[model samples]
Target: MDSGELEHPPAEELQVGPILLALADDNRRRVVAELYERSDGERLCASFDLPVSKSSRTRHWRVLREAGLVHQRSIGNGLYMRLRKDDLESRFPGLIQAVVGAP
Candidate 1:
């Protein structure tokens, strides 16, 4: 990994199959939306007052990260997440926007 790039589970190494399975839910979508609202350089911590079990919330986040939809960084005991906007946009143009704009 580059010095500036924090060590992360390689998006390539992650099991995309499991990630896809986990993301096929409404709750996961909400989690993504919540993260999307944050400004660049900001991260969404798991403990940020969501109405869900901690275990379930963790699973949701793992799905996003493993699927290459988001990037996760470990800071102390907390895991912070940010959407992989540019990467995903390049892979699937307008996919992020379509999902975010979905009602």
Candidate 2:
């Protein structure tokens, strides 16, 4: 399949329960915050500096992606992740802002 032709999962189909559970972790919350701080067009690679092991990092991102908090795509050998700001803001107003603001 052509890379441009691949479709990503819709935000509405995300599993809210699992997502909430994943976000309950401090490390996962930090990852979400980092993505939130980026510009709308920015993307974070899976190889970025994270405090967790490779397998655990994969789990964290998978939970976020499955929860609809982020969009993930395979680019060559790396997986790139981006925040689903619009969908999240619409679902829960000010939630992202509040989380980003929290100490």
Instruction: Give candidate 2 regions above 4 Å deviation.
Output: 1-9, 13-16
Q: In candidate 1, what residue range of length 10 has the lowest lDDT sum?
A: 3-12
lDDT at 34 for candidate 2?
84
Cα RMSD (angstroms) for every candidate in the order listed = 4.2, 3.0
What TM-score, over all chains together, does every model reach? Answer: 0.71, 0.78
lDDT of 2 by residue, 1-103 (tens): 5754334457566555766786788887887888888887346565467787989887777777777777777767666788888887877677777876888
List model 1 lDDT by residue over 1-103, tens digit each. Answer: 6543444455445554554564567787666666667778247465566678888777667666667777877676766778776666665567656676788
> Please, what is the whole-model Cα lDDT of each candidate in the order they appear?
0.65, 0.73
Residue 42 of model 2: what lDDT? 44
lDDT for model 2, on a 0 to 1 scale? 0.73
Q: Each model's number of backbone clashes? A: 0, 0
